[model samples]
Target: MPNNNQVLFVKTPSASSIKGNMFLYERKNEKQSWKLADSFPVTVGRSGLAKDAHSVIPLNDNLPVKQEGDGKSPSGIFKLWKVFSYHNLQNLKMPFVQVDTNFYCVDDVNSRYYNQLILADTAIKDFNSFEHMKLSSNGYEYGVWVLYNSNPAIAGNGSCIFLHVWRDENTPTSGCTAMAKENMLKLIHWLDEKKNPVLLQVVEE
Candidate 1:
C-alpha cells in the first residue's frame, strides 16, 4: 500500500543500530517526491524496530517484534489520530486535547480500557498501570498521538506510542518518536485534517 499524501517517513539504517536517531521527511502531495522537512532529529526505542502493523515484514530470530514495553519503535504505516499538548498555547489548524495528570493511556492487558485513553477518575479503576500523560512535563511538553492499536487493542501488544518533544539530540525514548520542540511545532502546524496525514516508519537495509 502507498502512504497517504502527507507522509512522515522515519528511516532507520539497521536493526541492531545502537543509535536510535532517524531522519524525518515530509511531502505535501502524493504526486510529488518527499523532501527533507527539517533537522527534526528523532529518538526511537533503544532496542530498535518492531513489526506493529499488518504489513510489517515477517519476524525471525534475527529481527525483533513488538510486545508490551519492548522499547522498540513500531514499524509500519500508521495515522496521526490527534494532537495532545501539556500546554494550552498550541496554535494549529486542528483541534488538540490539553492533557492533564488524570489523562492516562491504559496499558493493562486484562482491563476494559486496554490501549485506550481514559480518565483516572473513571469507573475503570482496576488496571495494571497506565501512563500519566502530562504535557507540562519535560518528556511530554508537546505531543501528537500516533494511532497504533486504537481500533481494537490486542492485550500485550503495545500502547502509548506518540510523537512528542525530546530533551535533546542524544536522548532515546522507550517506544516513541521525539524531536526538537520547534520541529514538532512545525509538524503540528503543517498537518492538515483533509490530507489524512500518516506516519511511515521503516527499517533501512
Candidate 2:
C-alpha cells in the first residue's frame, strides 16, 4: 500500500485465462493522476490467477489461493524489488543483479533459504530444489523480481515470482509473468527504484 508512482497493471481475461494485457502507468506524485506510459501483451501462469499474500480479499471465497507449484500466477499488488540480467546493465535506476551460473532462487520450503535468491557456491546446500538464474533457454535473460510472498516468506506459499522474457507470445509461464524480450528490456530500462514501482495483477470481475 505504499505510495507508488510507477505501476505495471496486468489484467487477465478471467481467473482461468493464461493470456493478459499489461499497461504501464506513471504519475508525477501521489496527488497526480496516473498516465499511461505503455501497453503490451503478456502471458501468465498456465493454470491462471490465484490470490496471494498481497491480494485483497475477494467477495467470493471460492477463488483459488496461491501455493507452491500451483501453476498459477499470484493476483495482487506487489513491489518490484530489483532487476536481473545475464549481463550487466547500465543507466538503470533500479537495483540490478548480474546473474551467473551460481545464482539460484531457492524454492525448497524446508530449507532456510526458501524464497530467496542466493549464491550457490557460497550458501549451504540445504535446499533440494531451486531455479538457476542463468538458464540456457534464455527465458530469464532479462527479468524483474516481483516481491510476492517475500516479506515473511511463509512456507508453502508461492516463491520466485518474476516478470521475464517469454519463449513466445503463445507460450504461458509456469507462474511468473512473461513477455517479449524487447518489451522486457523496455520495462527494465523504464523502471526507477525511486518511483516505488509496483505490479498489480488481477482478473476483471
Candidate 3:
C-alpha cells in the first residue's frame, strides 16, 4: 500500500455535482495506516475533473484535459505552494501573501506570464486577461495555491488553480475548488510548510 502521510481526496462523479466530499487523511504516531483527520464538502469547477497538461491540448483525447477558460478543475496531486488571504487578521503562521490590487494570476497563453502569479504592474505589462486575486469574495478570503503547472508554465494548460472559500454549499467555482470558511481555517491551522503537503483531487464514478 502506498503511504501518503497527508492527503486530501475530493471525490465527485457528476460534472454538475457542485458538492464534492473532501476527506483529509493524516499519519499520526501510528504510521501503518492514515487516520481520517477531517472531512468536509467542497465545490469544484463548472465542468469537472481533468489534468491541466500539454501546451496545445488536443480535442477528443483519452484522458480529460484542462484548458484555458474551461471552468473545469484540474484533478490530480498538486504540491501545495503558497497561501493567500484577503486580509491579515488571522495570526496563522504560514506562508501567506495578502491579496491586493497588484496580485494577479496570469492566464493569457500568448503572454510570457502564462501560469504565473505576478504583480499586475510588474510582469508582462502587455497582457490584458488575468485573474485579479483580490477581486473575488469569501472564496478569496483565504486559500492555498495548487501548483499544477507553476514550473515554466505550459501555454494552454490551466492557470491559477487554488483551494478557496466557496460562496455556499450549492455554489460551484470557475475552476478552483472552494470550501467553507471554517473548514478552510481548520486546514490553515493544520498545514505545516516542512511536510511539503499536497492536495489530491479525484473524481468517483
Candidate 4:
C-alpha cells in the first residue's frame, strides 16, 4: 500500500527467501509500522562487470530494449522519471515513438539520441549500431525511476534501463530491485507529478 506521502524501503533477503524482510515505512510521520507482503518472487541481475552498476529500472512494466551482453541488473539509488504506456502496441511500426515515452541512449559519443530524452513523436530509425547506447521504451507499469544524480553529466553509466520485475518478496535486487506486479501497480497508481525524484537505496549483499 503506497501513498503519495510515503517513502518505500524494500529490504532484500540477506540470504534465503524468507518472509517479513520487506516492509513499508512512512516518511513524514516517522512511523515504525512495517508490513510484509509475501506474494512476489525476486530475480537478481546477471553477475559480472555489468552488474557493477547499481540503480536499475524494474521489470514487469517494460520490455528489454534488446537481449544482448550479460543482461545484468544495476544497483544504486535513482528517481522515478515518468510512466510510459502505449495503446496500439501491435500496429506500431518499427521505432514506435511518443512523448515522455522514449529514452535516448547517450553512452555513445555519437548518435542523435545519445544522452538525450527523445520525444515519442520523433522518428527513430537507425538502432543497428548501439553497443554503447540503449533506447528504452515504456515508462514502467511498476517500480519507480530513480534519479540517481540530477547532474546527468556524472550519472548514467549507459547500460541497462528497463522496467524489470521484483526479485522476491523481501530481497535486494541484483542490479535493479523489484517487487510483485501488484505492488508495482499500486506504486504506479499513487505516483504523481510532485512525488517524483524518488530516492532509492540499493544495498550491497
Q: Candidates' lDDT values, in order? A: 0.75, 0.91, 0.77, 0.37
For model 2, residues 25-53, the per-residue Cα lDDT tens digits are 99989889989999999999999888885
Cα displacement (angstroms), candidate 2, residue 199, comes to 0.4
What tens digits encode model 3's per-residue C-alpha lDDT throughout 72-171? 8886676787889888745654588888888988888888888788887767486778888887466688888888877777888888899988899887
Candidate no. 4 TM-score = 0.48
lDDT: which is higher, 1 or 4? 1
Ranking by lDDT: 2, 3, 1, 4
Give lDDT tens digits, candidate 1, residues 58-121: 4334556678888887888788887888778555756588888889988788888887888888
Off by over 4 Å in 2: 54-60
lDDT of 4 by residue, 1-205 (tens): 2433344443333322222222343333224453332233444444311322333544222222221243444334344554433332223212222323354433333444433444434636534333211215222333333443234433234433433345454443434445566765554454444433243333334
Poorest 10 consecutive residues by lDDT, candidate 2:
53-62
Better of 2 and 3 by lDDT: 2
Which order, best to worst by TM-score? Answer: 2, 3, 1, 4
The clash count of every prediction, one per candidate, is 1, 0, 0, 33
